[model samples]
Target: MAAKRILIIDDEADVREIAKVSLEITKNWDVATAASGEEGVTLASTYHPDAILLDVMMPKVDGLATLVKLNENINTCKIPVILLTATIRLATQPAYVEAGAKAVLIKPFDPALLGGQIESVLGW
Candidate 1:
């Protein structure tokens, strides 16, 4: 099978690097990183990744806002998005789901299991 392509959008460089390495090493997936939501949205449209790992908090455009933009764009709307957040409250799940997030992954996740978690969430 072709390697799954994933785009990770996070303000933290370390997080993006960790996720890139984790996904690449564990699942042998094609991973791309964006330092901000704007870049992530641009890449999502052009790269047409299989899925997106989006951080919930950002300076200008937050994850929810970014998701909305992706959903608005014809090229990116179909791609599934999984939010990575430090704050995961039960009340927010419905909001995230309603905003088109496939799942919400808690922060400080185990890099070794990141690939499996994504696969499970995406049903890949």
Candidate 2:
């Protein structure tokens, strides 16, 4: 099977690096990173990644707004998006789910388990 391609959108450079390295080394996935939601949206259309790991909080174009934009575009609407958030409030999970997030991963995550979590969420 072809390696899964994943796009990660996060403002923090460290977070993006961690996720990119973790996914690549652990799963041998093709990974890409975008510093903001707008960039992510643009890359999503062109790259056609199998999935997206989106940060919930950002300075401009937060995750929810980005998700909306992605859903609005026919080219990206079907791609699964998993939210990476520092917030663990139960109330927010459904909101993200309603906004079309495939899953949510809390911040300070274990890099080793990240791939497994994503696979479980995507049912891969």
Q: Give the TM-score of candidate 2.
A: 0.98
CA lDDT of every candidate: 0.96, 0.96
Give per-residue CA lDDT, model 1, range 17-82, as digits (tens).
Answer: 999999999999999999999999999999999999999999999999999999999999999999
| lDDT, candidate 2, 42-112, per-residue tens | 99999999999999999979999999999999999999999999976997788899999999999988999
- Model 2: ten consecutive residues of lowest lDDT: 87-96
**After TM-score superposition, what is the CA distance of residue 38 in candidate 1 from its true location, in Å?**
0.7
Q: How close is candidate 1 to the true structure, as a TM-score?
A: 0.98
Candidate RMSDs in order: 0.6, 0.7
